[model samples]
Target: MTVSPSLSLAQRLRLWVSRPAGPPAKAVQFDRALTPWAFLVPQLAIVVIFFYWPSAQAVTSSFYLEDPFGFGATFVGLDNYADLSRSNEYRQIAGFTAFFSAVVTALALGLGLLLAVKADKVIRAAGPYKTALISVYAIAPPVAALIGMMLFDLHIGPATQFAALFGYDLRVGIDYWDTAFALIVISVWKQVPYNFIFFLSGLQSVPVSVREAALIDARSGWRRFVDVTLPLLAPTAFFLLIINVTYALFDTFGIIDVIVKDKPANNPMTLVYKVYLDGFKGNDIGGSSAQSVVLMVLVAVLTVVQFRLLERRVHYG
Candidate 1:
């Protein structure tokens, strides 16, 4: 390629930056071997400090019962995990966590996909519509929880009043299942916009020529979508599946914290929140560390399974 002599330096620089990348070479050599390390070191340092170091510390702590006040620690090998296994409350919370994660992930993904498909087809006021749909995502989880609390408030909340019309009392914090319902609704609502943004982008990235071909081949709209459009979306769907699961597991901490008002008595809560309550509030440092290690292992295994099993079905276009 030849540069235009008339072009300004800034314009030339922008052109170079925006130039399309070429196919990979079979073999390439760097002038300096340390050059790669120069670029990688900063990211490696961050990962080591933020992730691996903490993970190591948690594993160490999990094997010992530490004083909450940092007075001392007793080496109690595997007792923390054993306690978790034997405790009925821990088991119950674990069960709830699984159910909550599944429900929230499903709802968030399904609704987001549906909305994205609709938004992609919109011909009028698309900008405002997309903006309105995604605006909910900008709100913090705690704020969303606060909003949910007000909406589900027993006396003056619209949702509560609406439920009353059907002769059903919607007591959010007071009733276990009602609180779980509120938590799930708010969590799903918060997550849907993120999934929508990704799904919309994925839909838009589908080749127009491919879409035309699918249209010509399939007489039924649903058939065309299921056979062509859906397969094309498999990669995005799989990516979102992992993300949604992680979000449901860990990112809903603030939402649960705000809604439960720091009192987790008989209310539905996930494992991440349980770790917080145990470590910070209950001051069971060792137990919480054990829980954290458990979560880390669980997430890691889940990710591996997703890559191994789910990726087989994902046909990357």
Candidate 2:
């Protein structure tokens, strides 16, 4: 019958593969060199606009002393970074960030592994239960923070009341460590569902034959798990370690903000939170920009270390 002269060769091939009653073989061949870039242009533009441009601005701003009003930029050339390095408050912020990230990563990874193992063991209604467990990850970060705040509210919180009965208060506005601890718990809870999704997928990918062989050799279930299952899950655990640390470092700002109620009040504020406070609230643009640069460098260094040192133990299969 009649063929569409406008149809490109790739489009015609796709149509032919899907249906026999497709257009005739007379398809127009288009230039290939620019086709790939034509498809990529939209996405590349978005990335440049949203990511690269802002990053370049931050890098440039870090070298300048500016105000919150986005005017009167004077090039200071490393003075911002030098001042940040010498500040006691900045050092305290770094300590807070380290402790918070460590605790959140450990708790999230540990709980995720435990939950994934348990979920894997479920033979009945496994799909529904696993879906339910992972559904929390679908919640937005700010919304999750709100939920966490509500749950641990000192006066009206159910979890707080429940904890009070056990002689433990998990509410805010208590002590510096207490606030930090509550924030850590919220961060871990928010991260666990994501980590659980990955760990469960990794556990399911482990060859059943290998597990059965381990079962035949090891009499104890825990022993078989430690020897066979844990090793196999190492790659997944490593990935989640990086993600959890990132979430604790950057994404937990919402939860920290909610808990602090706008005033940190001598609380253990993280480096990321300090960046926000200094730049937005305190109106010290140069300091915040420098902090952002430091954070970027720290993450890059840690990622390199993970690839170099920790990745050797990862079992792909």
Candidate 1 positional error at 283, Å: 0.7
Tens digits of per-residue lDDT for model 1, 194-249: 88988888899898899889889999988987998899998888778877877888
Write down the lDDT that model 2 would get. Answer: 0.79
lDDT of each: 0.86, 0.79
Q: Model 1, which residues run further than 4 Å from truth?
A: 1-49
Model 2 lDDT tens row, 1-317? 21222332233333445687767555875558988798999999999999999889889999999956776889999999999889988898898789888988999999988988988888465688678867887776677878877877888988789888999866565777767767887888888888788888888988879878997999998998898999888877766676677778878888888778666758777888898898888999888889889988886677666665766777777
User: After superposition on all CA atoms, what RMSD does each candidate show versus the true structure?
Assistant: 8.7, 9.9
What is the lDDT for 226 in model 1? Answer: 94
For model 2, state the Cα shift of residue 215 in Å. Answer: 1.4
